[model samples]
Target: MTRSGRLSRDAITAFALLGLIALFAAMLNNRPQTTLSGGFNVIDGDSLSRSGDRFRLVGIDAPEYRQQCERDGVHWLCGQEARALLVKLLQGGSIECRGNDRDRYDRLLVTCRTNEDDINAEMVRRGMAVSFGSYRSEENAARAARAGMWAGNFERPQDFRREEQAGSPKGQDLFAAAADFVKRLAGWN
Candidate 1:
């Protein structure tokens, strides 16, 4: 009824309601899929265990729990430290992982995220883990900042595993060898 009038008040209200409904629908569609529910136990720096199931974090590699690194002329337990950091991250938070590939060790390779953020990405961003797959930029940033292992001298986790495999007794895993060594030194069995 006014000069060059466009939308009526009732029409504007209807349009606003429609826009809100669309936004709600889009949010629902974008919600993440539920993966698992339970408290997680740390398997290593880059893996989690829950109810006997193992989930390896996708696109990142962390040090083995027994690996060592030299920083400022001092040897540090980088592997164990990484595991501790991951454990801290999982405290009071549930993780949901999404990925279907079973790794060579039969662990589920997944991209896990907590309510706060992506667990895998956070590890790399913290410089506690090295990115593999599509997250190289994150690793680069950590390296630039000299974060975690980047601040010291240490072999990559895969290279460490390869060396251990070579030195291990035929058909015996490194973990078993470590356990056997421990048992022998402890005079158990």
Candidate 2:
């Protein structure tokens, strides 16, 4: 407020900015929740495709397709194993996914079920994936049982991606990693 008891120009600008941010938050919260059901093609441990659309299992992070882990001093393709488990879970069953959000890759972030089994939680329980924002109990159980990746040592998928990107030509990797770190900090991951 200025001497005249009216909002100053800077105060008005700040209020306008705050209003815009609130509106944006409301719009995002109001996005339509979607449910998809059908046979899906497993793209990886945490990704699926039906028809032409891609979906990512919500609140889980799985190994990259090329990731490796060591158990008993022997290297194993943990990424492949994760994908295989997902495939097995989908076998001889109906698959359904529901969500109201999309990831940075534009894939729908969904909670999926197969024949009444929650695939997302199952994956974490089996140690095929780690909890990103959900399934803490399942992850704890998997860790306690030394199941899947919990049985061995491996780089996190996100860490692997960051390292791989950092190895790319020029400084693009740093920029990308910085952007990703910022997104993570902002809870946009």
Candidate 3:
């Protein structure tokens, strides 16, 4: 080919290569976007109240208040337990926060961790809460297995909420009752 023709071909190739690189960079830039924050009192295994800004836990599922234990007639209140654990672990110091911003209930979704351990995974791995499926499938499964949720029968946090929303069992509200009880204990006048 002529010199001008060869030069034109090279130019086209260079533009194409640059375009590809731009696309790859864009993908990298638009990644999942998990943020980090600190200084929240993780009051329980499942919940935490924040002082300043907080990042939400993205993928994991936590137990609901009414989630019953697979064995015995006792109620564990797995959700509440998860929050309580967070509170206990986080209160000691500034915890790590990484995840989405808000949950369905408009609370922060965060994976909190101390210098000692990750409080969020601890809850699921220890059976206080559940592994979440919406964000990552195997993440939940792995957490479930690790947490020993499979030793017997139980429900996921999402499933329990769905049933409640569907009004299938028409069960009484445990959260409201418990909150009221707590208020009474605190002498809410």
Candidate 4:
């Protein structure tokens, strides 16, 4: 407040900025979810592209493209297997994805379906992917069955990415990089 009993100029400016931020947040929340439907190009186990737009499947996490896992003392490219499974799931049908959120990478975060199958849940159920935020029951079934990666020993996808980042020339500390990577992976920022 000013000596004249009015809000000072700086205070008014701060309030205006806060108001704008609130309005922006409201607009984002009010936006309707979008649905994308078509044949999709598989990018990885948990991602796909359609018409140049990339989408990350919601509620699941798959291995990095070069990640390896061990089963019965034999190493295998589990990431490639995951991708192949995703491709197999999308075969012979058009896919549909619906969501309003985007990841930091600007890929739409979507729940995808082909025919009557929930693609994300299927991935977790089959153990090609782990449940990130949904499909707990499916993950449980996969674990019980000892299916896919669940049958082997493998690093979690987020842990693998964090280690890779920490080893890079960026010079970030392992703990800090791990924290940041986990936050991004969990969509906390």
Weakest lDDT window of 10 consecutive positions for candidate 1? 29-38
- The lDDT for every candidate, in the order shown, is 0.83, 0.90, 0.61, 0.89
Error of 3 at 177 (Å): 15
Candidate 3, number of clashes = 22
In the range 1-189, model 2's lDDT, one tens digit per residue, is 466545577678899999999999998789898998878899889999988899999999999877898898999999999999999998848888999888888999999998889999999999999999999999999999999999988888889878877786443565677888899899999
Q: Model 2 residue 103 lDDT?
A: 86
Q: Candidate 1, which segments miss by more than 4 Å at Cα?
A: 1-34, 178-189
Candidate 4 lDDT trough over 10 residues, lowest sum: 1-10
lDDT of 3: 0.61
Of 2 and 3, the candidate ahead on TM-score is: 2
Clashes in model 4: which pairs?
Answer: none
lDDT of 3 by residue, 1-189 (tens): 999999999999999999999999988767474655566554444555566543445456666555664645454555665666656666766566666446666776666667767766665556555555433444456455755454445687767878776663235365666677788899993
TM-score of 3: 0.55
* Candidate rank order under TM-score: 2, 4, 1, 3
Colliding pairs, model 1: none
Model 2 pairs whose backbones collide: none
For candidate 4, what is the total of clashing residue pairs? Answer: 0
